[model samples]
Target: MSEENQNQKAMPASLASVAAKHAQKQPGTNPLGTGLEARGVHAWFGTKHVLSDVTLDFAAGTVTALIGPSGCGKSTFIRTLNRMHEFIPTAALAGEVRLDGKDIYAPGTDVTKIRLKIGMVFQKPNPFPSMTIGENVLSGLKLAELKRSNTDDLLESCLVRAGLWNEVKDRLKEQGGSLSGGQQQRLCIARSLAVEPQVLLMDEPCSALDPGSTFRIEETIAELSQTMTIIIVTHNMQQAARVSDYTAFFLSNDGPGLMVETGPTSQIFSAPRDKRTEDYVTGRFG
Candidate 1:
């Protein structure tokens, strides 16, 4: 395929009309400002037990960074919070993930609704390659079957929240893939925000970006944390220390991944109570 054709294939198509019919109805009210809690969470992929007895609380309006070595279940634990782990045929989780004291895993709970309340941004910028910039921002609302009276307003607000409004406002109809890598990632973030989620999960959202893009994403994260709970999985300890209010350290060696310690970001980096955490943060060991 030609480079232009490949680029076109990379950008998701417009979903404005679909979004208009079912855009996010509630845009003004902040649905998120509530804390999230995980209790005794354990996870398995097929027959391989990956995480064990993990528990943590992400306070409302705070950024919590999950840090550890590779293969330590940081991403697995993040997925479990929004129930994304269950997408795997053999994946299983045993624990309670609570949002504002309500158990998300309770019997009869709607998984779709749970996901809407908890939005996720993956490690790579996966904006719908066929969608326009504006359409990409409103795609989540369409998926959630929500309708808003003002889609234009919703698009602009979400893009602004993601720090992409000024840069892309003039090209709302442009393909999402037309933007730079940093812009595409921000567009993904804008798409997530359009759903009005209470908790946002980011699994290494900046891993694919250059340093400049990483800085912009970090800025966006800082801004978003003012109104929503954020849980991020990152291997960059410095990034964790720079952007997170609280940090949790995960480890795996002889057994399943486990939480070694969690505390304020400053405390965890400056004076970790656990030797494992100390070693990881100090670059002595991962």
Candidate 2:
């Protein structure tokens, strides 16, 4: 195969791997208002640089949207939080990411343990087809080997928390693949919630869902934020405005990605501090 074909194939596989990771549970939580913080982070993929001197804080109990055009390192920056970037053979980083006040990338840091506390939901709803809705919800618990008094009660509570219990309550054993796209996404969300994570990362979660389903997921996110901090990556500025408390815009320069502007979502949208942010938010450029 040609080099181009190899790259194309790798892209999808990489995306799938990313999707699978998002479907699973991750690290525990940081307190509200101090969920996660990245300071002076720089990363590179061999000679291709990405994420230069990026710094931001993700507060607990609030939704923070990381938005930017294609090629920008919005996804790359988030992947670093749970050490997902380590999967890339050429990836390298020079910075510190803190969960609460502890450095997540510090030596001896258990990457998997960090992920268990910081759960992730992908842009597409990729629930395990072989698993039932109930099985999907319990996937993380079983994987974590955590003991529980009443699995049924836990299932009911998590499903409800993801705004899915009432919808699929009677059909707990139904195959996760049998649900509508929106419900499946919520099922995925419920699955992430089952592990009792402290922070949730959603990457363009509604991009593939219908407007109604997207609305429901947004509603679920709003409710979930009361208990868990959420950081989302999205291209839809309107959705960012509607769901996020703060917004961080990324821009891809000649090398990789850099933060263009970040602040309260309302201010970023209505009154941005940077001209580039104003232009992007106003549809001037992607």
Candidate 3:
């Protein structure tokens, strides 16, 4: 057997259990967790093209990591998935972004609804300072006009799913910003979960965190992948290999960012097909 396959076989018993438990829950008819596809996608800020003809598929209930050096357009491409790129006044894109086979950018599509289905967690921990922890979790639901009879249960469940409930269960009323940086990031995750989004977009979610906190957030990602499609952009290759099922390597030279290769995580790390991908993975270059 391949070295990568052997290593995967030797994963810790606990982690294997976590993967087994949550991995089979497909997206079903729910638009939130459905598979996503980008076909011949190109993006530009005014006339400056940043991403060119990027075609990718993100399987439902799996984690796909976008990894590369800085200025490679990894972040920009992720933002485009949920239509966040449009927030930039000069930004525009071509090609199709499909959610469960339906084009999200089609005429008459509601941007707000698209965002609700695909939630984002930023690189830094951003919990609203003005709101309590409980309030923050419920904030998305409230904004979406989603009324649940069991608000308290919803809050607790989301927090629990985020792996933060035990830490802050008794202090839900505390200001969200009062928590430590790690706790705050988890809080942001809980807020995203409360909205029950199908796909979660994380842009270097652990970059600003310390080692211990980064580990915790990684655990949350693994657990959450069972229920939603997760696309993460990270410069840390180790984290990408550890958490993602699939990996895409993006590269940019004098022109727009382009995908060098993508495949199963084990294959990408063990035997990358492209020389550029091999160089980046082997620490030969960025």
Report clashes for each candidate as comma-separated counts.
10, 9, 2
The runs of at least 3 residues in candidate 1 whose Cα sits more than 4 Å from the true structure, single-residue gaps closed, are 1-34
Q: So what's the TM-score on candidate 1?
A: 0.88
For residues 1-286, write the lDDT of model 1, one tens digit per residue.
3854443333222211221222121222444544899999999988899999999988777788899999999999999998999998999999999988999999999999999989999998998988888889999888888989998988899999999999998999999999999999999999999989988999999999999999999889988877888899998776786778788999999689999999877656655678677667767877
lDDT winner between 1 and 3, please give it.
3
Give RMSD (Å) of candidate 2 vs. truth.
11.5
Worst 10 residues of 3 by lDDT: 18-27
Give per-residue CA lDDT, model 2, range 199-274, as digits (tens).
8998889999999998899889878877888899998777787777778999987777999898777556655668
lDDT of 3 by residue, 34-144 (tens): 599999999999999999999999988888989999999899999999999999999999999999899999999999999999999999999888999999999998789
Better of 1 and 2 by TM-score: 1
Clashes of 3: 2
- Whole-model Cα lDDT per candidate? 0.84, 0.82, 0.87
What TM-score would each prediction reach against the true structure? 0.88, 0.87, 0.89
In terms of lDDT, model 1 sits at: 0.84
Runs off by more than 4 Å, candidate 3:
1-34
